[model samples]
Target: MPKLISQINQLQQLGLNAKEGVVYQPSRGFFKIVYQGLILPNLPAPLRYFNYISLVGQPRIPLCYNAHTITTSAIDTATVLVSNSQHSVGHLKTYSIRRQCQFDSEQYKFDKTDLIEWKIPKIHLQRLDLEMGCNLTIHISENISNNSALQWGVSDYWSTLCLCEGEVFYKGQKYQVEGLGRFRHARALHLPFLSLCFYTCQIINLNETTQLAFSQIRNQWNIILCSRLDIQEFGKPVESFTEDVNLHIHRVYPKVRTPNGKEMYLPREFSWQCKKNGKIIFELYAQSRGDYKFGLAAGYVGSFQYQLSWNEQCLQGEGGYCEYIDCRPLRWQEKNQDEKILDKLMLLQPCLYKK
Candidate 1:
């Protein structure tokens, strides 16, 4: 048990002002609420977002949405890659959009339909697809309290874990879902274009009242940039693992191509351990479930099963959500003039080339 701080309260203040995220310059921060393992009885698999939204790239010029003027020149972007399979490798439907965003103390809305609301101990998210005439809602039923606020390079991070219940309405049917949820809000003083080399995050619930969350990043030279592990238990203080921890990704799958042709590899298996004075405090090994959603701008989302040992207690076969983003440079090949001409020709005569 240690001193705890409410990170959400501080984000509330920052979200209200336009000066914090800098409307004109490049900003590197975001507010994200994710509900993973949302079991839907009506659907084949669960529902979740493939990639979280952030202020990563250069903001588009000031724009208007729904006849509403956006004072903040910065734009918010996110991609929702929903799938019917729970594994990491599969066909995915991407809902990637850039829209004018509005943020206040209570709600953060992108465009007119997608919104992340803060109700305090009960977070509500609403995503409406106007074209498809579908709606989604996820309600988190716990308080968002963090063990600590961490700093790495020029970025500051605040994360919390909780339980969630969700529902989806599509094609005149209602689907109910529930699972573990997480809230993360991060801020970077300057643009983070070159701040990170690669990032990995995994979250799993060991039991009804206990959960394990791990995040690690490396620099361009394959050095540990920053890493953290959070052990959250109900009715107790959150614990952190930062020092003297040996975290490693034991194996990685071959490079896979996204639907859009971006190529990146993913972890097949990974393990980590925390040692103090030749005694093991915690250790975990996880293997991917082979289910995933790619085509998310050099990142992928999926599920994993893990075995963990903490304080002499052993747990196995626990499943969770995992995300890996490889920011390292990918091999780039310029298309020759003949290949470029062929691409244009195919576009002009798609029917002739239909297989």
Candidate 2:
């Protein structure tokens, strides 16, 4: 399909200007889409397919489509590892998540961690500078494993929608993107867009890091800074995988837009958290979306033992900057707020872990 045909088909399916997606070409041989980071339930092995289409006068274009691949990253030989990771709301939980991940390809090992972070029941406007529009649906439990000894089978799906543009670093692959990027999570918000999309998620490897960011849009000026390092060691696929991470609200603010002359402006307000495992390594908070001159960071030496500057700007409005730190303690103005309530809830009813 040519770009024109693809656009036509996409508009027909997704609606005109309703949502847009920018694409990326995977780094040659290591090209593959990692669907776990998406906000859907149950990702397939053959995440997506790109068919090169060209007609008489037109050049080659990839007709991107979604499909389910029938290949496991590893064989169905399994063992188990029990993990006890901390929830963000300050809870020490112990449970056994099936060991289905193959951390080591050569050793023929399928490992599983305790849990994954669930971003839910949360106010997206709780964090400043970090603004997002995420949709969440409740998943009722179902029985998958027969013999009903424990009386539970299918757990809930914790997924959310994310539209972001920035440095998409994962599995040693870097995707510096311009334009609004839409991600449908595999096995978690895991679906595909009719539009040509590329995924280079880094979470496939536990040792790897995947960070998607948006440059700060200041005084109507925009820019971006993107650099990625890819790694392809541990992205193997599986049959059915699920996680139970708790969503906690750190702060919430009602969004407001101020009118500047003829232009109306909505300044972002936010701060929130959800934990994976036993530690609170991730928190949602905001930085100052302040007024700066020139938009070009000129002759500036900065902290973090390195320099910082913007290299490109996306024409789309999805790009913005300023890192949001975890504002847990400061986020609460109400006195006597304790993070240990979640602990009591878990202890009072441990069956909350089951369906």
Candidate 3:
């Protein structure tokens, strides 16, 4: 028993054993943090240092945001504004989110110039109560090229009282979508090779007063750059946690052919867990709910809706998870290697698939 305990200790030291308060950096840029049940005063900033990277033959892509704002009005309405500028080409894009009351619930409208447009209809279960949870439906349209558009739909049941659940659909393919909505953030990255991939994160929300956020970043050689988490409480500051996590894949779905007939394998189910001080404190088991394929560079990439079960603080709940995957080109050693790099990145984290 003592030998087993010692081995566990060694794994913890190697950043394999998950624990709250222990910061783990597997390589130069990957950072991971785990917070058991602690309520942090504030939330930490997301990937502020490594904001942009320049590749050998590609343009310098900006990974950091220059400014963002959130405003709440008296009529139970809110607005979010975010802007980012590309350093090399001086290209700038701005995103706007407007949320307002609609009937007994709310509606969130998202717009981005030359990129995307979507509307999320949210229905609260209880009248005048935001804690009971809400129902959401999302219909999105993204312009990929002058001749084509990408369309998808997602339905979500979000609750602070119990578990959350939903489904995602694209071209008649449906995937499960379930997860906690207590805390989430939008992340955007521009790769000279792959263009831009945006990540929408949703995790389990344990309680009313506590929330956590984090990100895992990687590079071209499939090296992890960062995996960081931030814990925050209502009306308080934020505390940061870091650690490495082991991802176990239980199943892989059959390959689906894209519009161009390129085959892509999507993982149907997987599990992830983290430990703190040698005891398991957090874990997630998930399966794909729906998926879609889109063109990128010379290849195509995929995204999915996930059904998630999360365990933390001796408490377990079902929730939603969304992820993106990079696939291969039709030919070998294709000129655009960014998609290959994205495919290799699935090994970095269980729930996260970005660099």
Candidate 4:
């Protein structure tokens, strides 16, 4: 395939730099954005965002907003937020936010709400609802960025894959939304609770331009340092699989409970496969779609119903969006004593017990 579209246009030109923006560099960086189903039309209900602006190590409230309205079963009423204000990420043509990143306090009052504006390939988010109304906006209008953008390892992981189109204005009516979404800006030399490990991801759309994204990062003795799978399928280009993929994680019972109450256990099924030298290039399977969105970053966000298979073709994805992040060390959700002395000084870092 033209040498895989010239190696995905040389890894999307070493991933991002069309005037790169959104500051980083003063403590393990981070900048994220995620949208699932871009803005779909399939029986409404599939709008997501797992926003973040962390700079890792430097602490002090670093934005984490989490949007909602999902399904595979259910998930709504969500618009979580967190911030330390000081402008939550901005640049790259207004990389994000415009007003009230948060501040009215006397125990939270928040006034002007929110705003995001990018111009290239048009994007325009809005958020308002602390009684200020207007609640949603979204509007994509193109939002390019593809070739499964990459850049990896040693934690300087960059990412990209966008293909949206837009129209969404709930609470005042408006529909139209496209598919496939994800964009990341990274830099993390450590701190995932100092590498105790666990992270998972999925983003499947399978219809109007087939899509399927994958992610995995284990460690804490479970190995599997990283894994990625891209796919896309419409214009025919993206199809990157890293380390031949493997992923697994099956029927973990019902447990749940987080919001600091800590409980754990989730994964009512999962699968992954991919190979090259000895054949078999695809496989996937999913299940649990009963709604979940626990304290985010600490872990939880769910919805699934997939069934991919490649070479003999078989795609069936009725809503997909998954995430399961558990970077260990929740020493009872550390009620800060300087985070339990920085979790005993990152448990005497030995790279968290050898990877």
RMSD of 1: 14.2
Could you arrange the candidates by lDDT from highest to lowest? 1, 4, 3, 2
After superposition, the stretches of candidate 4 with alpha carbons farther than 4 Å from their true spots are: 1-76, 81-113, 118-212, 215-228, 231-236, 240-246, 250-256, 259-263, 266-273, 276-293, 296-322, 325-355
| Reference-based lDDT, each prediction | 0.49, 0.20, 0.28, 0.45
* TM-score, cand. 4 vs. native: 0.26
User: lDDT tens digits, residues 145-177, model 4?
Assistant: 331223443233434444554444433445465
Error of 2 at 306 (Å): 17
What TM-score, over all chains together, does every model reach? 0.62, 0.18, 0.35, 0.26
Clashes of each: 6, 37, 34, 1
Q: Where does candidate 2 stray beyond 4 Å?
A: 1-269, 288-355
**Model 2 agreement with the true structure over 1-355: per-residue lDDT tens digits:** 3644544433223211212221112111221222222211111111110000000010011111101111222111121111011011211111111234332211212222221222332111100111111122222112111111101211111222232222222233333422221122211111223222111111111112222222111111111111122111212211111112222223323322211111111123333222336554333333222211110001000001111121232111111222211111222322213453655566784445655
Model 1, TM vs. native: 0.62
Question: What's the lDDT for candidate 1?
Answer: 0.49
lDDT of 3 at 120: 25
Q: What is the clash tally of candidate 4?
A: 1
As a whole number from 0 to 100, the lDDT of residue 138 in candidate 1 is: 43
The CA lDDT at 20 in model 4 is 39
